[model samples]
Target: MDMRNEATHIARQDGARAASAQQGSAEFLTFRLGAEEYGIDILRVQEIRSYEEPTRIANAPSFIKGVVNLRGVIVPVVDLRVKLGCEKVEYNGFTVVIVLNVRGRVVGAVVDSVSDVLELSGEHIKPAPEMNTSVDTSFITGIGSVGERMLILMDIEALMSSADMGLMDSAQVLQ
Candidate 1:
């Protein structure tokens, strides 16, 4: 190849590497579920609020805690602990509702507590391994390593769609 062509090719490769590095270093909004801390893409988070008693709807799924009136619009809330099959815990002080925008849908996810956002580099993230009958690992996007801790990156869209968590067909539809 000509020297000019070679130089151009090398420059393109360097640019590609820089872009990949930027994409890999993603900022995640962290939250806790039991003792384990989970992370989700920061861009997708809409808002966070302290847990409050929602207007209960009859025939709703067990995981769903019913709808909450946010300003004027009613939004369904899902208890993460019950959704993840974790043992029931008292929602006294640390409980929070993380409103997430996933695939053009807005839903509030109930979590134990909200943690500070953290940036995880590509080298720090590892593919989720097959845990095999312990936990449903399908909802996990990947396992992110932050120092000595591992944050389970949740697939928000998948979690919302699967199991029809009240947002799909709740009896009480807001007019």
Candidate 2:
């Protein structure tokens, strides 16, 4: 089957499995950017907070909005929409910061807004499409079907390790 067809079929099967396994499944924290919804494993989420103005870093990429003081540790914040190359939009009442701990690093992801936490099964995850957007698909764990909405499951470790993100090089952060 073609990629699209395969993806569709997988989505359908995943939906069916999810419907039956809804009673007992792993939880994911869902969030949005523009119209697209995304999710991360709840195990990685440390906290969720209102959008805070971060200290800008020199020579950092556009998506890297520098670090924010979370308690005492400075954590870098990444704008999900910009990182995904989504169209820029004005930040209004919906902006939020999803603090995540991935591979021993605590980073905050700036998303449009958080939706809700969902329980999903492994069978309900579809592999990401290959040769799609410029954003590395390897960072995608799978595609989750939550009711009528589709949530992109992110691989937090892979995303944190990605060279382009510049997170792996972070040594001494502001205290």
RMSD of each: 10.7, 6.2
Where model 2 places Cα greater than 4 Å from the true spot, the runs are 1-24, 132-135, 170-175
- State the local distance difference test value for candidate 1: 0.76
lDDT (Cα, tens digit) per residue for candidate 2, span 1-175:
5565556546655644664565456789999888899888899999999997899999999999999999999999999889888899778778999998877789998999999999887666665655544334656656888578888887666676577887875452221
Clash tally, candidates in order: 0, 0
Q: What TM-score does candidate 2 reach?
A: 0.78
TM-score of each: 0.79, 0.78
146: Cα error in model 1, Å: 1.4
Residue 38 of model 2, lDDT score? 88
lDDT of 1 by residue, 1-175 (tens): 4554444445444534553466668889999988898998898899999999888889887888898988777888889899888888889798999998756667889999998899887777665554435344556767788779889887676677664554544323321
Q: Which residue pairs in candidate 2 collide?
A: none
Number of colliding residue pairs in model 1: 0
